[model samples]
Target chain A: MKLKIKDVEFKNPVLTASGTFGYGNELEDIIPVNELGGIVTKGISLKPRMGNPPPRLAETPCGLLNSIGLENIGLEKFVKEKWPEIKKIGPEIVVNIFGEKIEEYVEIAKTLEKEGIRCIELNLSCPNVEKGGLEFGRSERVVRNLVEKVRENFNGVIFVKLSPNFTDIVKISKAAEKGGADVLTLINTIMGMSIDAENMSFKIPRKVAGLSGPAIRPIALYIVYRVYQEVDIPIAGVGGINDIKSALEFHLAGSTLIQIGTALFIDPWIPFKIIKGIEEFLNKKNMEFKSIIGYLNKKRG
Target chain B: MRFLEEKSEIINLIDLGKDYYQIVISAPEISKLARPGQFVNIKVTGSLFPLLRRPFSIWSAKENYIEVLCKEVGIGTKILREKKFGKISLIGPLGKPFPEPSPEDIVVLLGGGTGIAPLSFYAERITENKKIFFAGFKHLPSPYLLRRLEEVCETLIIATEDGSMGFKGLLSELIEKEFKNIESEYTKYFVCGPYPMLKVFEKILPEQRTFVSLEGIMACGFGICMGCAVKKKGENRYLRTCTDGTLFSLKDIEI
Candidate 1:
């Protein structure tokens, strides 16, 4: 069960979504990291971010709202302190990078290039940031420019993580493909907020956060399907993917790789269980990776 | 360092009155590894409705059972209270343990409402140190908890805000009154409760000698989400409540 995106082959098709996996070192004792296909580190910025205020997380019906605001160790400290530890994990390590400006994004990617990172996921879709998060990602021109700058600077695989807050997801996908993005992470968390009605105050200090979990799976699947129909680039489906059934829906809708996000909070062992479950299903069906991926779209009668 | 994800069956669920409850579970492995400040994350239901797990400090662990003191404040705890004898997942003994105190030191355990849970457990573990338990409840606490604390603490002081119990004032005022009578030797205070109670301890006691267990909204009770962050004193960065500590010395954190 091998999966390839942009000439880089993955051992499997499961990965832990960024921000949800921490530094990939925390869960090493609970589950073997090397056994999975890959892991995306929590988003890193050019300069260290202190993140949002307290009460950053809240639970909704079948979902979670988080305003973490991309709190990271910054590029210098991450390379010096955290990168040494991150590279030791067995799976492919994709560094999820964010920025307040276009230059910062390029700077973070260029620094990662020097460290020989195989792939970098440009976080253009964090709902928590003020400048370059979902704001920069909503416009087609801005996405193309940002991706093109990083593509010119770094030679490794580049993934553009798209936000679902946009008007037309297919247009955003096309812009990323035209700007030389090797792959596209289909969706990020949906923008949302919660309130404590009794106190009449916002649950998160930032006033808004990203919504994730089983609540947003159907929406992610639809976006992946639309993006798959419009672009030829590989898709890494993320958001609300909890089990193998969720993962299979992404594959059937034309996703080559799937990342598990909020559900990891419930069970850290979910990724391994999903990998084994997928293997069993593939064995039972006498099918291969290519045969199942985009099968529904191909046979659309 | 030992942690278990056990489907613990509720052995007893008693309403301590005023929406507070004591849930006792038969979990031998978790009880064996349990220490003073460590907490457990309980999955309220099998459904994904209340998506994240709620964390509770280990109130007391005896023989083969561990207990948690919970107040029905939110949706998760409300659902938790309605179910009796239902099995749910429990992940523990998570977070750093309370530092061990020296034999000659006098340990003062000050608790407000459900915060009394872990302090009682800490009192049970210490036989060398002189224990003084000061508890403040909105009203009178359950007889079971009062008797249990009385059994372990050398001196038990009770207070209630509504003037229905021993001292008719806030817990801070009760501490002020009791301070004059007790000689200040090698004294250390372990305080847990609302933020205001912890603030009072920070003002009155030496930072090095005061230990406070924090309560925050945590998505992952281990260190993954970086959600439950507390500001470090005189620093720009934050410390994770789940991994860095549920119990921290007053000198290290701001409230």
Candidate 2:
């Protein structure tokens, strides 16, 4: 049931997505977080982000909308104040890095690489922000350039997280792979909006927000399956994956790894339970866990 | 962290008037760590919907037991009331606590409905200070909570809207009347209740010394979700109630 990406080996393929887990220290009082495969931290930037205005989040039918805007302390504060506590958890830590400019991304990536963080997830597609992420992610040239620039500076496993709003996900995946990206995390939150019809205004304080949770799972799985075919790099599937069944769906769709998001707000223990459930599923069916990778792609008649 | 599965036992359950219940749990670890004005997030046993834990302020904390006064307004508290003496899972000491009061200061605690829980612990902790508790209920005081308050405070003032209890007025009126004769120099106010009550208190009291505990529906009892954020007055940034404070100096917050 174990899966290896680069030099790091996970006990299971199930891990929490960045921005969802909140550095693994917040949930420590409630649940034993070490039982999960690993944790991806909230995106850390070169400068601290104050995030968006109030009413930053709202609940939809079976999903959530967030415009948190990647609110995080800067790299200096994170490494000095927060990293020591995060390191105490002992789970394989993957630092998710974001920046407004290519140099800023390389700088943060280089810093984390030197600090002994095994992996760097380049956040090319955070929908809530005004610039950077979506701008670079939607274009093939910019994505390729940024990925190569970061890859040149950082030696750690480089993961380029992709956006769901794009029409041509395959082109972006190919560009990332061409630039020497080690992994691809499919489908950051889909760009969406909710309006208060009575007031004739946006529902969120920020007019636009990112839609996540069970609502985006189908689209995410579609992107993962599509990208897996085009790119040889390992895929870390994410988006509305709440439970074991949902995670297994990504594995079948050609994702070698999976990230659980949105669902953490609903139930923090979901990732741990999903890890356990996958083992149970594999045992009952008498199948190797790795055998399911790309299993659905070939079976599609 | 050690998850003491056996420690979260419900020792007593009392039905207060107006669909409220006083639940006393024998959670020694939570009690030992909890400070006045802090809260606990509780998950009701065997409920599929409302899967998130509900945040409740610690009403009282003793050596081996802790108490929470919950108003049965939603599915979560209703399910919480049905549990027997041996079940429930809780996660807590989740939020920041009220700052300790000065020895010579006059502590005035105001609460309405279920918000009285955290203030009761504040009253219990400040034994050296002179304390006046103004409690408002729709009808008479819940017998269980009233008795618990009597054991902690120096003076207790009861007010009900319907004139079904002590004073025939609102709780804020009683607070005004109590503070009328005394000089404002020695007073420090701490309030947690309905937003309107807190809003009015924020206006009436001195800005520097008064602190109000703001309540909001929280999915994550932490800074991550940005659910329970209150805008800091005149500042661009909002502060998270779970991390920065559930208890904040009245001067810093914008109602």
Candidate 3:
């Protein structure tokens, strides 16, 4: 079950995706989060965000569309308040940082480095926000430049989370690797909107929100499959992973690690289920854990 | 802040007519700790189309079981309304409960649609108090639910928008009229209904004493999603309905 990327040895290759898990303290009583490889905190900005207005979430078939707008307590409060509780949890805590400005991202990274944080996941793919996020993710130059700037400020492992919205995902993945990212979190929620026919308006007031769940699983897996072959850095697959079968598909498609997002709303215990099932499958097949990752890539026609 | 995710067994699903139902489930742990105003998020027994769990107010909680007043409004309830027997996943007793009423003060409960759920739960708990439970509907709800509700309240008032049954007026009108007949100085109001109903009371009801439960477009039913947002009355910020409240004071929030 041990998966090591550089000096960081994760207990399992399973992590809770950013923005879904709060500050990793919301479900302490309900789920065995310590058993997870890492807990990704909500995206923290330089200042506290009140988030988007109400009617922020809507359910469409097997997925959810959210315009949460990356709501979080600012970096100052995160380190002063949330970090104390999150650090006590057994799994590695990855502080997911977001910023509207490149300078803000550099400042946050420098602050986290000084605070002795082990890892930080850069959220360049959030579709709900106006300034940073998807704008930064779409341009290959911006992705590489921002990662490089943060890499200089922070000595810990840096994970760059990218989106599959419009631009070439392969181009972006290669850019993150070239910019000194330790790992690449493949595919944030795809940008989407649903219309309420009765009201003759958009389901989400933001007009466009991030689409996540099983609906986007195939997209995420394909993105990971494509990006894995293009970059040398490990790919942390995210988007629509819910159960063991879905989790394993990512590994075969070439995800070194996978994050559970929208399904956390459906079932909190899914991570545990996937973690145990992966170990069982590995033992049954008599295969090394690492051998299964991208194993299907070679077989695909 | 703490809750249990119990695999509750479905004891029965009784149709109360007029699109209302009483779903009784076996959940000992949840039943033991649950109070009025708190809710449980339940996933339908054998379906997945309605991916998110539906949140229901605790209509009743007895020795080893709990009930929710289910109204067939969407795909989630349409499937849930027909589920007679099996196991379903339940996560509760969530959110803050209504502040406890002192025996000396009078309690008023105003409800309409499925908002009658938590008020019904509260009515049973505070049966010993001098309470007035006003159950409003566009037409009459089933006699079973009405009769059961009447038996629990010290004084029960049934109001309908249409003249099908009881006082032919909105519950807000009924409450306003009742205030003239009954003393208003010491009455503490607990209202749960649609926004139009709640907003009307925010004007007529005493802000300091009135507590209203607001519903949100929920996903997790817990605090993770940050989806269920309610604006604070005078502040430029938001509060999560799951964590901060599904229950709030009339004076503290804007609708």
User: How large an RMSD does model 2 have?
Assistant: 4.2
* Model 2: colliding residue pairs: none
Question: Model 1 over residues B74-126: C-alpha lDDT tens digits?
Answer: 88899889987898888888898888899888999999988988899899888
Better of 1 and 2 by DockQ: 1
Scanning candidate 1 chain A in windows of ten residues, the lowest lDDT window is A126-135
Alpha carbon lDDT at A16, candidate 3: 96
TM-score of chain A of each: 0.95, 0.94, 0.96
lDDT of 2 by residue, B173-249 (tens): 76677666543788888888898788778767788878888886566676557666687988767788777889889
Compose the digit string of candidate 1's lDDT tens values, residues A166-270. Answer: 568889889999999998997889989999999999999888899989998999999998888888888999879988899999999999889999988888888
Ranking by DockQ: 3, 1, 2
Q: Is candidate 2 or candidate 3 better by lDDT?
A: 3
Model 1, docking class:
medium
lDDT of 2 by residue, A1-301 (tens): 6777778877778778988888668778667777777788999999988787667766565567788878888899998888889888867778898888888898998888777777889898743244533567887888899899999988878888988675498898899999889999998888888887878988788777888888889999999998887778889999878788889999999998899887776567778788888889889989898888888875322
